[model samples]
Target: MWVTSSTATALLPTAIALGNFDGIHRGHQEVVRSIVGVDATGSEDCSIRRTVVTFNPHPREFFSGQRRQLLTPQEEKVRLLEALGIEQLVLLPFDRELATLSPQDFVEKILVRQLQAKRIGVGKDFHFGYQRQGTAEDLRAIAQNHDIEVKIVSLQACGRDRVSSSLIRQSLQEGDIPQANRLLGRPYQLAGTVVTGQQLGRTIGFPTANLQLPDNKFLPRYGVYSVRVVLEKTALLGVMNIGCRPTVNAEAKPTVEVHLLDWSGDLYEQTLTVNLEEFLRPEQKFSSLDALKAQIQTDCKRAKDLLNSQL
Candidate 1:
């Protein structure tokens, strides 16, 4: 039900929500949830398709730097939007050709010519077009000319601050896991493929699944954490370390090591999601392997208590 610009020749008469939807945070959800037509109530629409329009390469990253860490990759975005009742996902490439579109051109080319959208839901602060000249007001004015309707949703707030991906990223960078989790409406998670490790954990009676995070994925503060491990069909309780293994004299390159308390499977080369529930402490270099193993045991106990309470 999801297609990029290259594959999209035609689409259904959809009611569309437009934005990057990075992190798919609370504020972004408000825009998607507002597409319930003039009556405004249901999360899903049975009469017509509900679609999401987001840009590939994120406009911010396209204009700025490729080194920017993405909150949710395109694959992850598809899953989250699908759960929120979006039937179609449209990805517009954010290259120079798209960047040159004027406000009027954008309204005609994509919103009308391609989508033929029944309704459009956007944030009050949403902007588009060449040089970022278009505003929500501009969109509404143009929509009236085309006999289309637009809904502008107000921003959602977390405590005194507005909920935003930037704010969430900042919280994670600072290692404020609880604050980040609260804003996300879920735990902050990172996904990576399990790779071979030096077998140091097994030598100490604790075996671990080592993960090398993808290059473009954002990482939180380098430290130890209480986490939830997501396998293919089930979740497990775990403790994780996010850093180079200083005690073992490993390389300076950072890696993730997860020790699932109740899991004994062979996870090599398998992709897994590690959800950071709470920050346990900064990664420390124990003077001895015995000390490191003992501290890990302590961390396991702490993680089990926290996870059991969640259950």
Candidate 2:
């Protein structure tokens, strides 16, 4: 999909899907699919673009003192939407002005004037406008005046629980990789550039490529994960550690280190995208180097078995 900022001028009529789309989980995907589906099943309108209108800094980040962690961040979010066949992405800035626009103004200015949307889609719980006063029904009522078709997608669920970004975050925080993956419709991933480390892993005979996760990136429970690593054109099975390495040094902060099985090469300054397939154990302090090395060997074996079974 082609990405355009909010300030860019819009010329084509669009079938737009609107939301923060934090994780772009199953529910978000369903909503997006509906937009693509509409374009597919409706009349051949060459001017109608399949577009996604998402926000930056997220809405919650503006209203609260605490910063919220993101599942897909901005770059990854774009990649995911593009993969879903969206034709256009309009990343609107979320500021005081946008936060205070009335429901009517939002519809008139964004949906009508800026996007020229012929049809729009969102999840059932979507709210917009000043003080979050608008509802799906309100959106429907307002957009109709501009001859816009509305699609309010139903809530998706995982068994009894609703499928939502918050729920997925909770799963990731709790290190429930399988649950998070189930809700996300895919494995939860962290993409970052591989940076140089202390090279302590080399002494332990398990040299690692250290990753520099993006700012405010959401991390699962601190420990070990059985992961799939994407290194340039090759995919490799790997065991990743997300911890401070207490067995080595107590003064250090947490870091992500990956030991790729059956592969060896210089990876510094390269991008490495790690998909957390399963959580193995929590980070803990060990008494001796031998104990840590023995445990790491066990972890590697367990990770290999888990990763191999999936293949």
Candidate 3:
């Protein structure tokens, strides 16, 4: 999708799908699918542009002190939406003024005037306007007056549970990778820059590249996982450990340390994206450094076996 900031004036009039779309999970996918499906059947005169309207700084972060965990970063979210055949992505900056717009003003100014949306798709629970005064019903009424088409997609459910970003976060926190993947339609991945660490891994004969995760990104449970690491655009098999170094009595800040199979290089400051393939084991406090080293050896063997099996 063509990603553009709101300040960019030279954008096409388009049909917009509105939401935070944090995970762009199955529910969001359904909305996008409806837009594309409608666009396909319309005549040339009815040709509508497909776009996504999303906010930065996430409204939750601004309205509340809670540091909401995100399933995807802005860049990655745009990339995934583009892959799904969206024509454009409108990134609206969330500030005090924009946040406080009334329901009518938001519709008239943004949806009708700025975006020129011929049709808008939103979930049933979507709320906007000052203090979330606008509801799906309010949007429909506004759309009717403005000659805009409104589609309210019902909530999507997976098994007995509703598919949502918060639910996905819960799954990750509990180390339920398989269940999280089902909700996300893909494996959970983390992206960050590789940074220097204490070099303790090297001393234990298992050198690792420590990564600095992005702010607001949800981290998986602190444990070792069979993972696929992408460095400099190449994918490698690895075992990743996410937790404090309890065996060494280190401070409790969470860290992601990856040991790439048969790989050696200066990866400091380089970005690496790690995709968790399977939950290997939970983080444990080993009796000694030797015990930790021995466990790592076993972990590496299991990781290698997993990779080979996949191949």
Candidate 4:
């Protein structure tokens, strides 16, 4: 996908779709599909370019001090959009100035004048402009005046609930990997670097690689999980414990300690991507070191059995 920072010079006379597209969930997919469908029927090669306009730093973060964790990183979002056949991505930097633009100014300057968009697609619930005064009706009026066509994609539903990033996050937090994957159309995974620890796992018979998660990244609830760890090109089945080490009375931050089955390596500083496959048990404080070690053994056995069944 071609990525452009400046929206002024980036957009050609294109058919543009607009949204935050945080998770790029199924609902967002419908909007993009509509744009592509329109593009496919157009006769001129460059008469209409297909593009997506999204913001950086997430507009919510500016208003609210805390922001919901993102499901896909910026790079990952770009890659997924490319796979969906999006021709260009206009990444506008969100700041105070952009936030204060009037609804009419935003449409005239960015959408109509700069982009020269002949067609536009957006979700039914999408909002924009300072204080979000821009609505679907407002967009329709603007489009009508400019002779641009506007398409509104309805929300996509999975089962009874509508598919959304918030629902996906709640499912993951509840250890419902299956439900999360169902909405995401793939397993939820986290990427982190392997950092050095105090070697406590070594003393207890299971050596672990300590993981450092990215800042602002959301983690699943603290628990022991059956997971698949990808290191370099190989995928390894493992049991991962995510929590503070309560038995040792360590006041450390939450870490993902993974024990790779039948694997041994010097993985310090290397990055590992872990996919939580199933929730085995919640994190608990054991009374003694021996008791904690015993529970780990049981967890490992269960993880191995679950992985075996899948193979």
Best by TM-score: 2
Q: Is candidate 1 or candidate 2 better by lDDT?
A: 2
Cα lDDT tens digits, model 2, 1-311, are: 67777635644788888998988899999999878745534766666888899887688987895788888887898899989978788888888999999999999987888787888999999999999899999999999887788989999999988999999998988999999999999989989998989999889899999999877888889999999999888899999999788888764567989999988889999999899999999999999989999999999999999999988
Number of the top-ranking candidate, with lDDT as the measure: 2
Identify the runs in model 3 with alpha carbons over 4 angstroms from their true place: 7-10, 37-49, 305-311
Residue 288's lDDT in candidate 4: 95
Which ranking of candidates, highest lDDT first? 2, 3, 1, 4
Q: Write the per-residue lDDT of candidate 1 for residues 98-184, one digit (tens) a residue.
A: 999999999888888788777889998999999999999999899878877889999888898788899999999889998888888
User: Arrange candidates by TM-score, highest first: which order?
Assistant: 2, 1, 3, 4
| Per-model TM values vs. the true structure | 0.91, 0.95, 0.88, 0.87
lDDT per residue (tens digit) for residues 65-89 in model 4: 6775788777668877888878899
What's the distance in Å from true for residue 249, model 1?
A: 2.7
lDDT values of the candidates? 0.84, 0.88, 0.85, 0.84
* Candidate 2: worst-modelled 10 consecutive residues by lDDT: 37-46
Global Cα lDDT for candidate 1 = 0.84
Question: Could you give me the TM-score of model 2 versus the true structure?
Answer: 0.95
